[model samples]
Target: MCGIVGAVAQRNIVPVLIEGLRRLEYRGYDSCGVAVLAGGEPHRARSVARVADLDEQVRETHLEGVTGIAHTRWATHGAPVTNNAHPIFSRNALALVHNGIIENYESLRETLRGKGYEFVSQTDTEVIAHLIHSLYRGDLFAAVREAVQQLHGAYAIAVEHKDQPNTVVGARQGSPLVVGLGEGENFLASDALALAGSTERFIFLEEGDVCELTLERVRVADRDGNDVQREVRTVAAYGGAVELGPYRHFMQKEIFEQPRAISDTIPQADSFDASLFGDAAAKAFGEIDNLLILACGTSYYSGLTAKYWLESIAKIPTQVEIASEYRYRDSVPNPKSLVVVISQSGETADTLAALKHAQSLGHKHTLSVCNVGTSAMVRLTELSFLTHAGREIGVASTKAFTTQLVALFVLAATLGKLRGHVDASLEADYVRQLRHLPAALNSVLALEPQIIAWSEDFSRKENALFLGRGLHYPIALEGALKLKEISYIHAEAYPAGELKHGPLALVTEAMPVVTVAPNDALLEKLKSNMQEVRARGGELYVFADSDTRIVSEEGLHVIRMPEHYGLLSPILHVVPLQLLAYHTACSRGTDVDKPRNLAKSVTVE
Candidate 1:
């Protein structure tokens, strides 16, 4: 994944470019650079540090231009070195910034080398610059159009030539690129969030679409070079929403914002309605007998939790698959199956590809459960539920995951209503539980001080084991993922019953075993699993419901949950694990917002 922002304006564009890069840096921050055609000549600055460093370099060097392209790279093909940074130029006559991978770059490099084109950086992106350079006879748009036809992989590129000031050419193949419309200026970025305050109007570039931006107009063309018009959307800046108010980190803010996020995701209703998703959802739910959920990472874990809800509550047979692996394997196609794709950004490349893969296999009825309403996944699906978790900036998702669970639970309840599995009393009770979730989450937030105390021990830990059973198993998996992601702790999760099968051998005093002990049917069996871990001299840190009767002992420590929320227990139980991971990362002094080798959105496969 990488970030791209470009501008063709009447005034100096360096400040706008830098600010955009700062906003987009969460997308990628290995290296950053900006190149502008200043007075019909190329002026540039780059850094292998944070985007702030790049901003300082541009300011100190007085780099300003009427036209520019900037990038924050997340090193896919090359190392995060200064030379490999973006704004890759061709003889200083043309400058370009790109996001995504080039699959046929090696061959393209060899072909360009035969034509006297020299490569400077060890990046696949450099080949595109040289290729565009060779194609530039006079027209920048023509050259870009010709160059992208030869590119074999996903890319969203913005190019500016020295010969053409106040003109920028942008193209999108498999990555996201949007055009921001403004008076006397137009912008291009990998995400609309980058151009939030800069502009309120945007045109989401379609696949194989190329566009040229100037001070006055924006032109778009299809892959075949046919002129086309894309609908312009007015998007809110939400700039104030992302601000960290009195919080140490964005992760902490998002963790504490869970109550509001969950409340917004599930509106207060006496009974869940299928119309809440979309008009087509009621008919589609009645037509489908099975559910197939495709997602990646945290979204995938949410889908796994949803599988239990969908099967048990709705009585629908559900299957959860990792999006990246779904297409590669052969599987049965069910026409009656409702295919669901879960994502936060909704631009996740693998998940989008998997959705298409499922569509090709005849799974026609589809739904998207994601945070962003304007994302590719939501646009492609027949029905969508936008989790109103506004702008999750932290690399490790907090509010987004919980909100997705809330949406999925609502979806399950709606399907149950449609399938006649849920009576009026049961449906009303589900709504009551949903409405009470926010207050329940606030109570869970009170346990943060205790969770922070646990983090003191977790900071010294190198490895950890998390155990859960049934629906909570996925919560354990998500907790392990969060711990490993932000805290740099190697953590693994397994069903409590599966510990003796293979993971039991890993138990020791050095290994901190965390168990999600809800007072459900499996609590007694989970207690037995705890005994096995204690027998191996492993210290157990348990997050148990008050009714579970789990007591603190010499080798065992317990933090009781605020409630045992029945069907919604997973949502309540995961908050403390999130707090545990957050505080542990804080205690370890790791970069909680931008963890190394991770991006906020995986826009590239």
Candidate 2:
């Protein structure tokens, strides 16, 4: 739910901590702070502004040290203000930043109240700082272990002590924390991406694991005080240079990055062997008679689209579930089913929990389609298909959705071929069609100008309805999600046939209706649905195929795509919707990339 970074380095670690928090800004925070242990005290600066503002505060205060911890707070227990900011001190001995909720903080606060301990801020995290300080016995590591034993909930914490300036202690129970290996420095962060620029070597902590970091070495141990050997693996740097070179916002840049992202996901889509999924892919795909997809947010809509592909193309019985809901519900477990989890950041809390749920239920076959290789999803799953959509920084998700669809499409075709549901000739034809996607995507991106113009009009409206049929229904859902997420517009999507059931009553002159029309068998039916909206005086914003004949009229508006793609049409159709949401958010003067109350990754449940 929050971002944390701690560094013990030879050179000044303040700049490194700032950069690490900068990379994690997409995690959605309300305030930021940094604390450095200097001259037997913590020199700290905090702000209720962006990280840049906090950096300026650090400079103004001259807070400099080689060992420190920094945090970007996503407010949970307290409001986003300076008093509630992190890097909170405890009896002038230690400062700590925490990432998760303490379920028993009220009782802990009451207990500490009688121990002659005074409280400063209304934060659950400050309890940990004081609790650890109360248990101090000369060793910071021992103090943190004792403090964590009394805690009752999930946490990923990094601690720094005034007396132990060269040492940092970290522990994780339910949230993610990693140790970065460097020549003369060691780092701790909630994600490896925070340390991507400085180091590739990392050690990922398991549940109930704790680590002590120093400038010379990193020591990892489990909860029982026994030393543990965690593997140190090298990872590729994530999201190289997240600079807005030409685009207006990160959302705009990510919207335009779809073509490249999709292309990178499947460079050899035409000739890609089934082995792209790793050595066990063929065996796993052959054994599974059913497929279950678990995901959340935009990844959930991608799962919905893949349901169409898996059933029709692969001829497999597929069921899609929202990860958060799926884990809580009691569902039948089919051992033969392949449990697939899709996430841009592999650390999504609900999806990872769902994967563990399926695993605990004895569903042997499992796979993960994820972007971050170091994520919990990849490490826990039996098989994996890694997407090359590096560092999707936008909170609303532009390129990640398209690239996930690309990965799922590849999975469908590969499974179809292995199951004899598709002939080799037809599969070759599908692959050829897939090859046309990148270029087809480029042609589709050219429609942005038209979408921008449409946004100028639609932005004034506060409500919108999206309509689609068959496989494109998921695209319509995603379209509405983008609109509501970025533009703060009340938007809903329904199957075209459901218009008469209820939603048609909401259509009016002030409400714009967006229709996704491809030249499929359901085109005529979708047109009829659009007519119903037009008859209600609802302004029609139709994203039509190049030759669908859905032209512009008085109450109707249209943006024609370059060409018609058959099964891959959803991938192309979504691009314009992303542009529409981005431009509309721009028109309304809303935050496009980092919208209100949304995080790039849901690392906590």
Candidate 3:
């Protein structure tokens, strides 16, 4: 995934483009570049390290322009290098910045080479500018359209022509693109955050949509060159609301903010109105007899958790499908079945396509639980539940997963009430407990200091094991995922009972095994599992309820949790793992926030 920004305006566009790229840096930060059409020629500056380096170069070079496009690349097609960076230029120096993959780039490059077009870079993005240069007649829009049609696979492209210095043309197929409306100016970005400071109103581009933007106006067109009308929605810049308060990283801030997000998701206690489901959602769910959840990564884990809640609490048969595998399967959906798509950024290409596939199978009921409001998946779905986790900058999801759980729990409760499986008193009790989750989360966050101490053991170890059972098995998997994602430590999670079966053989004196031993029905079983690790000469770091007293043996390092919390203990137990991962990564000199070869959003399939 990469970030793309373009602006056509009367004012100096360099500063605006740079600011926009700064906001969009979380999308991709491997390499950054900016191309400005100034003095009837494209002037480009780029860096292979960070956006700040590119900003420094921009200031030093004094490349002024009224129109420009910028990019922060994540290095998919080639290595991260100045030559392989984005804002790729044509032979005549017209610049283009692109996001997503060009599946047919190798074939396209061969064709361009036969035409005597010498290439300067190894990026798939470079092929587009050369193709445009070869095919350019007069109309930049026509050239861009023809070039896009020839290209295969996902892309969101922003092109600036040396001939048309005041205009910026953009097109999107599978990647995200947005047009920000401003007075005598227009902004183009892959996300709304890029244009937050510039304008509030934006028009989201759909698949096969193209637009040409000028200082005064913007025009939209379809693939066949027909003028198309689009709905422009106002985007409120709530950037300040996402502040981390006293936390170190957004991941830590969000890890502690889960309770608040949960509370906000379930505002009412007494009301079990079907109207909260929205009209389309209510009608869809009412018509469906079964439900299928499709997602990937952390969202898929959440979907797994939701399957348990839906079947047991809501009394509905449910299935969870991974998006990548679902597409290739012959498994079909019926008209009476519903498809629930879960994605933090509704722009996940596989999940979006899976939603479409479900719809094509005559499944009319499609609902999405997404954090991003303007993402393509949200637009494609019939109904959406927007999570209030704010901007999760970290690649590994912390708050989003918990918030999705809260939303799914509430939805299940609502469905149970609708089916007469639950009563008002029971629903009210769950809602009240949810309201108290924020403060409980704060108490859990207080364990970070202990977690930091526990991380010292991890810093010296090469491998670790995380163990949990029942509903928390998925949470343990998530905890292991967080550690491996940030710390680059080889970690595995298993059901505590399964430790003796196979994973225990990996336990040695050098291994540190972290057990999620919350004071619940499975506490004794988990404690026995910890004993097995200790007997095998394995060091232990246990996160348990303060009330659940266990003998601190020679190899046992026990972290006393706040208290015995029901259903919410998994949420509490995960905080320490996140802290452990962060501290361990810091000690190992690894990039905690931006792990190697991973982007915050996987926009391409």
Candidate 4:
């Protein structure tokens, strides 16, 4: 949940390292720091704030060096303070920056303390600096290798030694690391985006691989310190990483881009031409009698939504299972059954393991819907659908979820057409409507200012209820998730018809009920449900189609959407809810991007 970047060059590279850190800031960070080796001395500057603050600090301090390692930290073992910031230094001032949790650091810290090692900070990362210093045998690479050998748990580490001024050492185990190759320089970062501007050529470091980088070359080795062969892959860089561009946050940019992503998936709807899903997947799905979906978090919700689409549209018997729970369950899948896994990162450990488990059970027809191209999940699956959501930075997912839904919807529709359940005209109409989603999404985005005004009431309320019927019930659930994830609000969603059975008891005058009253077959029933909430003295906020003349009376607030887009209305309706959540969280002084106790990618189960 932290960002790490390093650079080794023939000329001063502090500026490049700082720029890289700024690029990676969207990953979420509490503190920022950089350690540069110049004239055989390490100069480190760190601060507890945004990367800008650290950049200002570094500028004020004038830390110039040709070799450096930087980190933007999301605190794990220590509080967010200057002392706890990364680029944690050894006793002699050689600095180390690390990503991932060092699970055995407490024991290791105690061991080091017993040996009279003085620690200046309370971070698990600081232990590595001390360990390297203590075990220094003149070779920075050897020292880092030895220190890493003594360490335990997941890490992507970048270290710079004061005595060894011309080199930087990087190692990875269970965490991501990449080496960017440039003329007369080399860059190291936890992600390719961090090195976007510097170079497109990258050597993706695999698990247990370590590299020693100098201005001229990068040498790779295994955990056992033996020489290892490596392949360099070229990455496509987009200028989007450098600027937000017409959007306030990356979340907003991504949200507005959903229509395009959906459109892209729709055109290739029935054509599974991607090599990731081969003949095996086509054959298996052609003969399969059942389908199983395994996923977690928002991906799991996407699967749940797909279960509805698949069952109704394709007449397929489907089951959606949370990946974390799927492993231990005594559930079984036959060779004639297809297992579909959905994940944004596809590096999510539990989901990846679940895919492996399903494969081991002889379920040969495995498919994955993932965003990352080279992720382990994509590599392991027999077939994969790559979501074109681009980069989703916010911990609370917005665009990725919607894109996953689009992919699933298209998949279901494709299956229906293939099975002769849908006609050519129906397919053409679906594609036409899907193409118009972008413009419809733009219409929804225009409602943000109005939604923000309504957020004033939500900011004061402790509890909220989101209600929808049928397809929109899932949309309501997703809306509630956004509110709770970022705003820290006590929010729940229920099918509007189910209110009488239970959940209505929680309704009171102080409570706010947000209803997704889209003009559909269930519009009248949803209006009745709203009336039920009003009878309980609950204040209401309704997102309705312009034609659904829900009267604006006492204790009621209605924001009429421009038009009714039918089945695609859920995609548009969710925009106002996302805005409500974002504004509420902003007003409450909560972290909208990186909510407390949450990580962007669930790499661990």
What lDDT does each candidate get?
A: 0.92, 0.90, 0.83, 0.83
TM-score-based ranking = 1, 2, 3, 4
Candidate 4 residues 29-83, lDDT tens each? Answer: 7889898887677888888877888888888888888899999888878898999
In the range 164-240, model 3's lDDT, one tens digit per residue, is: 88889999998999999999999899998888878999999878999999888899998787889899999897564
Lowest lDDT block of 10, candidate 3? 238-247
Q: What is the lDDT of residue 147 in candidate 4?
A: 84
Superior by TM-score: candidate 1 or candidate 2? 1
Candidate 1 Cα misplacement greater than 4 A, ranges: none
Model 2 off-target regions past 4 Å?
238-240, 267-272
After superposition, which runs of candidate 3 have C-alpha atoms over 4 Å from their true positions?
Answer: 240-247, 546-549
Candidate 1: tens digits of C-alpha lDDT, residues 13-97: 8898888888886664799999988766798898999988998898898998889999999888889999999999998899999
How high is each candidate's TM-score?
Answer: 0.98, 0.97, 0.96, 0.88
How does residue 575 of candidate 4 score in lDDT? 78
